[model samples]
Target: MLAVAAGCGGGGTGADHSTMNRRDGSASPGAAGHNDADVMFAQMMIPHHRQAIAMTDLVLSRASSERVRSIATQIAGAQNPEIRTMSGWLRSWGEKVPAAGAKAGGMDMADGMMSDADLAKLKAARGERFDALFARMMIAHHDGAIAMARDEQSDGRDPDAKRLAGQIVRSQTAEVRTLRGIAGGR
Candidate 1:
């Protein structure tokens, strides 16, 4: 069983329109209110989601199990839109949007992201080995995301950002359970 490290951060599903309007009576994405936590959440989650997408893509071509493929597909479906949503929020906030292909390393890997070497091993796996590896890795990945989302819920100031954090918590928590089952609770 691969042990996932803890970390301290999802989606456009939650839009708190009540807080979206500025005092000037104009609408803005993150203009309603945000703090450094919100900024950090967006910055960190983008690459995390990208790596998850990459992991799912790797399984798509190699895994023979229907369950694994389905889970991978669902992950990509949910996260691809989320990546765009976070990117948009960063743009609205005048923050630097991380490049899509950028690999997380060193301090950036604090989010429980798989290292490049881990990804390489996952990419090199095949058949049942691939499915088991994918399950273990994704479970850890989802746990890290859940931790970050919980933090965002507690510390973030933006309504939209907090809402998205809650969504990630709920959705990814469930996904983690599913992945755990696939991994035989490893």
Candidate 2:
């Protein structure tokens, strides 16, 4: 018992993304009795989702491939709702939501976020260049989200946040395969 308690003392374990119930059997209202990990997950993922939507918007205007454009539309359709959901979580948690125009916030590289200059370059490229770059960048972007999601799954305290983390990992993993297919054709 002493050894178990010692091991679980720190948040570094990244386990326990399971059904968490307090002795009182009531989780914190909207925050699901969240810890710092939950808060960080919501805050970070909000901007990451925003950037993905922006990239999809670019794909709509520039990409000539019907499949690519269609996938972009699908991505925006999926992520916009998710963005709203995360925002709600943040508000419910009494945490400040990142601005819509906020940059990647932090962990930009780890989060697979594109820089302003990278976005500008993507915007300027035309035809195949656009399609290929779009797929490549988005794959990288999705990969970052997956990584963050996995972290949340291991470390987050909120049940909703951890569940969403698992979902993100699954969906984005599939999307990465699709993106790879799209990039392969080029």
The Cα local distance difference test for each model comes to 0.72, 0.71
lDDT of 2 by residue, 33-84 (tens): 6666766777777778888888888876788899798888878877776776
Cα distance off (Å), candidate 2, residue 55:
0.5
Error of model 2, residue 74, in angstroms: 1.5
Q: Tell me each candidate's TM-score.
A: 0.82, 0.83
* Candidate with best lDDT: 1
The per-residue C-alpha lDDT of model 2 at residue 162 equals 72
List where candidate 2 sits over 4 angstroms from the true fold: 1-32
lDDT of 2 at 99: 90
RMSD each, Å: 7.2, 8.0
